[model samples]
Target chain A: MDSIKVFAPGTVANVACGFDVIGLALDAPGDEMIIRRSEVPGVRISAVHGADLPLEASRNVAGVAVQALLQKLEDPKAGFEIEIFKNIHPGSGIGSSAASSAGAVVGVNLLLGEPFSRKQLVRFAMEGERLASGAAHADNVAPAILGGFTLVRSYRPLDITALHTPKDLWVTVIHPQIEVKTSDAREILKQKVLMTDAIRQWGNVGALVAGLYQENYDLISRSLEDVIVEPIRSILIPAFHELKLRCKEAGALGGGISGSGPSVFMLSKGEESARKVADTMNQVYAPLGVDYKIYVSQINTEGVKVIG
Target chain B: MDSIKVFAPGTVANVACGFDVIGLALDAPGDEMIIRRSEVPGVRISAVHGADLPLEASRNVAGVAVQALLQKLEDPKAGFEIEIFKNIHPGSGIGSSAASSAGAVVGVNLLLGEPFSRKQLVRFAMEGERLASGAAHADNVAPAILGGFTLVRSYRPLDITALHTPKDLWVTVIHPQIEVKTSDAREILKQKVLMTDAIRQWGNVGALVAGLYQENYDLISRSLEDVIVEPIRSILIPAFHELKLRCKEAGALGGGISGSGPSVFMLSKGEESARKVADTMNQVYAPLGVDYKIYVSQINTEGVKVIG
Candidate 1:
């Protein structure tokens, strides 16, 4: 085949309380890309969906990952025509950069006869992120590539491990109409933390980890609390507290900001509860006169994949 | 038999990052208690334990739980001879109170014709802890009663969950001679935390939990990091930095205080590493002139049990 089309789903990064370390794949529709073999080594890019992202290899996430993967080839002369479908917006806490980077790597590497392991491909995707975010962190890319729940333990060695997310977990995500830039959100964070808050956070961290292994839903729900980030970031999202309170009251297991916010997500027990949570959230936002989107989705165990 | 001899194992409470929530039972070498039949409703306590623990029913951990369990009976008339085999030290962060409580509940429950479930027995144990610490936290008691890694989501309604622990994890613990009270150690902590650190702690928590399920040893090792409690508590364990440094240099997977401890525990790849870690810790404490106790053990899956 001279060309291929691949679909990369949206993802939730910084899983509440787990920030920057945990990323989960979302089944909700995301971005797409089509890559075709060409004679030039560098990628030629175009976007069909997202608003005016730079096409230059130096500026775009997908462009960088494809470039890195091609440079790995014996014949650096290999080229590709890349078309991106950007359905999930940047700063949505849904791994926008990841969907782009992962899509490009998965699509291009397939065109290259699949010489690299999935881990190698994920590493290649890291370069895609380096151009945009000052640092190359794998939280987003790792899950987009490997699926399920993922942990980016170390960035230096680029260690990425996929975790077993419980089968029963249902995720409800709402992206508000308001826009919050990723860089701006990151800038708001303080460099240093208080010692006391740090201990509570760690204690919750300890409890949360134990909860997941034991599949203790109640423990996981209690541990879902974010005394640290959620309080700070919720201010950026519209109706954060009211919406979250309503969702929990409507039977959510727990919920918090999705990444650096403007987007919020909640965990619900079953389909019925998930639907109830979604309705409750939308109801709270109804009076805000803001255009918002809500997705009552399950945890996307199967992540990025083929869609022709 | 006028009195029956029961052995309750020492345990590592608040295993690493699992503060206030996780704990486990150890093999062999623990506290021993003997309880004999009595004619009255109230529990009379006696401790063979060398430490100056109070022998009165209202003051002793064992006596308290036995007293509470008997109080629940319609016929409150119960009598017993209580004897304790003091193997685990009270302030060692090995679940001293938990062992005593579990032993008391076990012996008395057997005497009362087994009125409760194994879980119900844990509830009885928590009652014992209330007489000691103002809070009836079950991180220690649940694990001691049930064995393995226990998650105490809430102490109020008594929600406890047991998690699977990987068999390959060989534990190496170093208990220095210095003593630090849990209350005092707890007092050193601040009530608040930085959002960033809290996020990282939870991420590691999820990673650690996922690691246990996936049997990803490297992830388990990496996730073993305790960024919050260790730094504060380690200050009390003289030369803790050197001991940790040596353990890492000798190739241990990362670790921290066994509980709220003077005891440092690290999980290793195998028996050799476990022994090496023990030796390294011993060497680090030599200059400090602190005598040490060591456990070159493995994760104990079996929890509270009567001495067979």
Candidate 2:
């Protein structure tokens, strides 16, 4: 096919105690990218929408990823015109850039007749994240490319592991009308973490992985405590503490700042509890008079997919 | 039954990247404890053997743990005579203290007609660990009581989760004739850890949990890295780096300092691989002209149990 379109789901990274390691794909608020054959010898960002990202091929995450993937492909002379429809908002702390990057690589790979593996695709996509966020992290990219829950086991070799996720699990996300730059959010974090807090964080991370595999909701909730990152990052968001408390009161298994957030997400046992969490989170934001968007979604099982 | 005998399995806490969270029980070199109902009004340590543990109720880990359990029992007035046979060596970093404490609690609980749940028993056992290590951590105790692979999720609630363990997995442990005080081991560790190291550590921890659940041997080996505690603690053990490299070269999936040091453990894919790993590790320690003992066993499916 000369033309192809792909859908890449947004993702939630860090997943509370799993800072910089764990992430999960979402079913809504993703991005769609269309790649069409062109006579030009290089990738070009032909169109953009929903967010004011750069049109420059080198600056755009999708273009950067596609370019990286093309350089590794045996036939690097192929030309493609990319059009991006960004449904996920940038700086929402919900992996908007990852969706664009993942979608672009997936779409371009399909156009090239699938020369690279999903793991290789993820590496190329990470270059996109590096362009967007100044760090080549796979927490967002891996899940967006491979789906469900993912663990960026190590970065040196770019090892990523897909983990067990419960079918009944639901996610509730609220993107408040605020922006927290990824670089700024990251900079606010301390260079060093106390050994005490680090131990607690690792314990929760281990338990969270076990909880997912066992499909134990209570274990997941109890293990969601983020002693390391949340305490530092949540301060930037308004009513972050109350939002978490209300989300929990409304039956959220657990809630925390999504990514680096003004966006906050919660996990629940079922759709009803997820909607309840959304309602509670929205009610808090409504009183604060900030425009917000809410999504109640099951975990996205398929990550990047050919849409057309 | 007026008297009961229980055997508590030895455990490897920290499990490389897991730090103070993940642990697994072994099949051999455990502590055996005997508890008998008595007319006295309190728990007492009647006899001790195979080690230099104190016989005083408050001083001994087994006695201290049993005492803590009795305080919450309605029939606290009933006394119990405890005799401990320590087969797991002290300062071996193989949960020696935890085995004694866990075995005591399991034994006395059987003598008291099994009123408490396993979780409560672990809590009481943790108090014993505090007496031995001066820290109320439960990585070793939880696995010794819960069996298989376990995660100590939280300390405030004493939350613990039993994770899946591959049936073919094998453990190899070697304890050199050296003592690295837990206090000294802990002291040598920095109060603050670099964020880079902590991220790598937690990533490995998450992947390790995923590996156990998925039964992926390569994932297990790749995720076995420990950047937080191993570097600091391994220095206390002689030829630690060579031991690890030799163990891996001999077919160990992964290996590291068990708990604080003086002992190292490796996980292999099968019994044969475990024996190879043990042989390789022994070759390293044997040349040091130091006394050492090797154990090659499967993951203990049962924790503390009535053997007689």
Candidate 3:
């Protein structure tokens, strides 16, 4: 195949108490990228849309990820032209960059007859995130590549475990117009978390995993608490606490800062509840008069895939 | 029933990366207690064996736990005589006190015709543990009461989620002839864990939960790292590092400080591997010339139950 178009879904990272470990993919508002063999012998970002992103291969996450994937190919001379149609807004904190990077590598892998494993694809995508976020974190990228729910069990060996997610799970995400730089959102966190808070978080994280595996909605709701990261990162977002409270009151099992800030997401038991949560979140944000967008989506079972 | 005997299995709390959230029950080395109705009102410790223990119902964990159970009984005036047969030694880091507390509550609950729910029983047992350990932690006690793998999702509402334990999972526990007081074990830990170590620990915790749910032994083995608690606490135990290494090399899936220190346990895929791990651990400790006991058994599915 000369070219392939792939769509990668947006993802929610650091799900409440999971901090740097757990994340899930959203079925809507992802990035679509089209890759074709180019006459040039190197990867290139030929076009862009929706958001102003760097076109230089080395500077762009998609470009960087695709470049990493290309190096391992038996035929290293392969050239790629990429067109990015970004639907997930950049700096929205809902894994916009991850979608782009994951989509690019997944597309390039398909176009090259699929040699690398999904874990390798995740690694390549994480490196893409590294170029964008200045940190080699895989919470978002892993889910975008693997789909459903994922756990980055260990970073040293790059171990990723695909967790069991309930089929009826729905996600409601709202991205405000305000932008919170990932670096700034990360920098505000303290270098040390109180041992007490860490213990609570550990309990919640374990319970959240159990809830997902058991398909217990009440357990999931109760486990949706981020005592450490959220207390610090929520300050960067406008009306984070109010949004969370209103969302929970409106039937969201639980919600938190989607990635860093600006965008927040919640999980619900069903489509009805997810919509109700979105409506309530919109009602809360409407008075603020901040330009924002809302998405109600299922937990994406299939993460990044070939569109055509 | 006039009298009842119940056994609460010993448990491994923290489970390496899980710290204070994840734990599992072992089949052997548990505490057995007998509760008999008396004409006098209130609970009392009737007989003691195997260890020097407090007889006061309020001062002792089993006594304290049974007292909590009595408060909830329909006839608070119902009297109970308790005989404590502590097969699990204290200060061994293998949930000795938890076994005592759990066995007490389970026995009393049975004697009173099982008036409390497992969660309530866990709560009462946690209170029992509080009298033993300074903190009201439930990681060890919850599993001891509920059986199998258990996660204390939240302590505020006292939420405990019973996790899936692999049926073929075998555990090898070696208790060296030494003591690491729960208070001293906890005191040695720093109040603040480094952010990097905490992140690594969180990833492993998430993965360990996923492993339990997925029944992936390899994943569980890979996730059995304790970057935070083990580093500081292991210093108190002799040959902890070498024991862990030898156990892992002996085909053991994973192992770590059973609860705090002095006693180390490893999980294996089958009984053979478990025996192999126990032998290796014994060899490592035999050179120390200190007395030690090793128990090789399966994961206890039935936690606290009526024995006779």
Candidate 4:
């Protein structure tokens, strides 16, 4: 097996009130994918530090996307060697699987001479996602592939559209080492929400969208409040309130749990506030003895850069 | 005693996701206020017709706002005799009370030689709403008084800001005769929400704002969805699903409960679709004994107009 390349940027899903539908790509700390031409029409996979994912085409996410892309190409007689430099952790709620799926789809498609639209590539990536999450949800993959602010309207056929993202918006992500499985986190949620809560949710949703478009920081800050899921989920992550309060005090507009648990994100206007938010999150975890990784990055405008 | 006339147009409050915090003014079918400068102090009010609102100074919303404004003046000696020319119906969920309050406050304040600022007028209008609804919320009043799109940060002392509304957007409001008591409607609501729901709300909110800024109709239509409130509240309004389906079919972007009740608002691009939406709404309600009133209006850039 020789060498080839694929890259997928990190993403933030469940952004504010757009759960399961909205996501944005981050500018930094993305994974690099390299795929080499191989014989026998068979695929091989390797993560950073020689960490190997499954080789079976049906079981591996990257493998499936690659296979899907290759199938779309005529003469599936050629195979490829794939390598992923995994900067984004698997359970960070930062579009971990999305990176792999998106990277594989893009990388393999690139190797096969780009035949699909980015939206078209979404379905191939979504098929790859079903291997890990047991379902194909494009909130992560759509944004990772399309870049900018994205919305996945329909999950089945994959209707992905990129919304306008403000230029100066800064994002800070703090992933506490504790793990909360997405399935478990989802199971804990009540299926039926109260009428009052629903109204409040939509009310905040409207405000948040308006805030983003108008660049109204105060409205965005106020709209950042999530009375619905945050109260329950925050109970799972200790020091949640402390981090939020400290981040707000540190001049960060607001921050909340990233996706399901443990990882909390803070959004601010400038570098100072972003750095301050990171420091605040670090301090909150100190006494709790929870070591964590911090990501201070801008909204990723260019997603899935292939390593040459 | 000479009566001074003022007018305030109907408004849409809660503006989807900025629940209880955001609202926009409408252009037509507003309420007219007649304020008589009198020697009888402490502010007096009488409702001739419209919405069956209370006539007493304490119970009447207009009376309350007038009192709030006059009480602030030294030697609160100016008496107010208020009358309403009710165009917008009560329980229409179209910021009915806010129109009267804003108009009364504006009328009486003008009689008193313009003593307070516009923000102060919003505060004064809240007094009226406080008396009627038992809560001081400026989401509607702020916009009716100031015009355009207004964000109500708080009600106590009333923190308000105006947004620049795009020129091309048209609004279609359908008021079905079904009555859902505001107090009872509010009581059935839950105090908590899922954090995930909150994120979705903010995401839609962000999208809506972006739609407005870009004046992108399809994007605005997509962003117009109310996953949180519309779902729950529309349950109370019969044929809500059918009504929304019809509105969208008729060329409106999306439809949701206007404020808290039987009325539904559909946003459209131009005159044709807006008219079509009103017809569709009427068609939906005719079979349910929900006699309806419909308004085809622009963004209502000028919130309140003074009647000569």
- Among these predictions, the greatest lDDT belongs to 2
The TM-scores of all predictions, comma-separated, are: 0.90, 0.95, 0.96, 0.83
Error of 1 at B99 (Å): 1.7
Itemize residue pairs with steric clashes in candidate 2. Answer: none
TM-score of chain A of each: 0.93, 0.97, 0.97, 0.91
Ranking by DockQ: 2, 3, 1, 4
Which has the higher TM-score value, candidate number 3 or candidate number 4?
3
- The 10-residue segment of model 2 chain B with minimum total lDDT is B69-78
Q: Provide DockQ values for all models, in the order shown.
A: 0.46, 0.86, 0.79, 0.29
Model 1 alpha-carbon drift over 4 Å, by segment: A72-74, A190-200, A206-216, B1-4, B71-75, B127-135, B154-159, B190-196, B249-251, B279-289
Which digits, one per residue and each the tens of the lDDT, describe model 4 over residues A68-90?
77777766687877777778877
DockQ of prediction 1: 0.46
- Standalone chain B TM-score for every prediction: 0.92, 0.97, 0.97, 0.93
Q: What is the lDDT, from 0 to 100, of the residue A172 in candidate 3?
A: 95
Model 4, B1-308: lDDT tens per residue?
26678778898886766566667888876898888887788777766575676778888888888777877786656777887888988778998889989998888777777888777888889888787678887878888999887765433334466766778778888887778888877766666656455545555555565566667677667756555566667777878898889888988887577778777777888878888888888888888875777889887887767776
lDDT of 3 by residue, A3-46 (tens): 99988899999898888889999989888888998878779999
Query: Which stretches in model 3 have alpha-carbon errors above 4 Å?
Result: A38-40
Please, what is the whole-model Cα lDDT of each candidate in the order they appear? Answer: 0.76, 0.89, 0.87, 0.75
